[model samples]
Target: MNASPEDPLSQRPSRIRVDLDRLSHNLRSIRAHVGVPVMGIVKANAYGHGLVPVARHIQAQGVEQLGVAFLEEGIVLRQAGITLPILVMGGIFGRQAVQFIEHDLEVTVSSLDKLRQIEAAAEALGRKAVIHLKIDTGMERIGVHSYSAAPFIEAAVASRWCELKGIYSHLACADDPGSPMTLQQLERFQEACAHFERIGAPMPLRHLANSGGILHFPQTHLDMVRPGIMLYGVLPDPVSRRTVDVKPVLSLTSQVIYFKVVKAGNPVSYGATWAPTRNTRVVTVPIGYGDGYPRGLSSRGQVLIRGHAYPVVGRVCMDQFMVDIGDDSAWNEDEVVLIGEQGDAAITVESLAQAAGMSAYEVLVGLNLRIPREYRYS
Candidate 1:
């Protein structure tokens, strides 16, 4: 790890280091591939990459718009002095409409009911609500059904208080090559676009390509693209194996707080689930379930020390876990990397997710807020 020139190792214990340089490269690369207005998705704390910092950095790169899953996330960006246009991917609820309008944030109207509520709120505020219509496409989650979309679009366009700025849909199976659902969704979205054009409704900014859709489909890149996971430097799916050549922006590092030796047949950690069949060098790390390292990782997980992979040898305790270094004397009170590169050997987020039986998205976002995040450009 590169330390600050002024004060090397000034404050070090446990931290998540974010590589701003890598983030910039990823954002630029994804934008080049999409060839359209790229809205950086910063929901779930920028998919656990630290929201405010990520947003500010991406915004500096000239990303015009941002998307978040909740209204509060938009507020956080606004509070952080981010003046870029932000859209709440999910629609605002009853009481949230006022807050959304107050901050000049855009809202996605997923349901007619949500549009009605937004209309009521807009009427009270005496301002037209800038809304995006989320079409069901094939996801069948929140969007209007394909067969009934025409009527819904007509109603929305006719509303006096609602200004439809965009018509968007989400891809459900773009990551899975075997799933033909994406093609169907694309056809449905194009159909909706055609309807809007035929009816003389302003062709709102049409966006349907998400990260997976942009990378896998390419043909679905409409007016705008939302890149979330790709911004964090990982392939969208296992099959694509067309590695996104982007650098990982997050590195998890911790110090060896203490160490000990266990005689043969001695057990370690809770439930005594792990036993040292032979004498072993045990190292304790100050990280556990509360810190976002999945509790389920217990004995199955691995950590890196001196560029070597070591087995996690016990039930991961609340705030600590044991690593059996196997009588190796190369380790002591030294820094260790639970996730990220260590020398030539490295542990990718994919490995951690596999060990914990989680998707790469979950692994990144699962990192709890308790862990301090340190941002660096070099």
Candidate 2:
């Protein structure tokens, strides 16, 4: 059951399965929920689900735009023949402006000074740079503070070389519906947008909602919505309400490569962490921290096998980990479920994040390039 017949690489014990249909369903669901154009967040290698493939799948599904955290990510999409509008939201330096313009990627204008740098580059190239104004509402991260956004907005509007495309801000607490910070930030964003009216300039598109905002606050869905982790069927916060019915698009499964009977009181794995009080059956899974599976999950994580959940018995190794099955029977080449379902039991990314003492975002992006990913339309 661990092997994929459609994929030759599935023969490898450790592999990732991405359901493009699930991704497509999530994109449509998010758009229907927000009633606005969707900005699919495909950064962090599409949250470890493979960037180019996810981008291509989503782009064909009619998402209005794509958002990435870096210039190189946007360029990669373009190189892969992605033609949808892409905004590099990671905030750019004065130097990265040239590549942004050359690749037809959108720039995030945070300050008058930063705007000027990009303006100069666009002017030199004889191409007006398309840009989005990022206002610092309350995140206090990047962007012009809402209190002083007037001057920055004015300068961007007056710039001859930069074409202001959209104005947006990142939500810091929209994930927590009980947090007052989101409303305050939204108010600040609204006040900042009012500057266009004050100056009698055309208002650019407004977007402030992230995945949390999309689920919790409808008012934040102005001109567009950006669904990051949620687009991949994961919640920003485990407690966040699931307003949209989105299914997970990624699954990590492997085959049991080894089986043995560990004698009572015999320690296992690195650090000689734990041993069974009685003789127990154990199996080795061919994935570990080296594959971006968190080592912190050692002895704490659970995996599904043969329709039952088994605890990881000891410290996870760089390339392998052991699981205790007690009196149950298992054999070599049996399917091992890490972040997916087996029978009625499921190991979700949220549950994995909780067990690993990490955020769902981190857990997804942490599954680095070591594992090969195969896409499934079914």
Q: What overall lDDT goes with each candidate model?
A: 0.83, 0.92
Residue 336, model 1, lDDT: 79
Residue pairs clashing, model 1: none
- TM-score for candidate 1: 0.94
lDDT of 2 by residue, 1-378 (tens): 134576665567888899889999999899889898989999999998999999988888889999999999999889989999999998788888999999999999888889999999999999999999999998888999999999999999999999998999999999998888998999999999999999999999999999999999999999999999999999999779999999999999988999999999999998888989999999999999998899999999999999899999899898999999999999998999999888999999999999999999999999977787878986
Cα error of candidate 2 at position 144, Å:
0.6
TM-score on alpha carbons, each prediction:
0.94, 0.97
Find the 10 residues in a row with the least total lDDT in model 2: 1-10
The most accurate candidate by TM-score is 2
Lowest-lDDT window of 10 residues in candidate 1?
Answer: 1-10
The runs of at least 3 residues in candidate 2 whose Cα sits more than 4 Å from the true structure, single-residue gaps closed, are 1-11
Q: What is the C-alpha RMSD of each candidate to the true structure, in Å?
A: 2.8, 2.1
Candidate 2 — which pairs collide? Answer: none
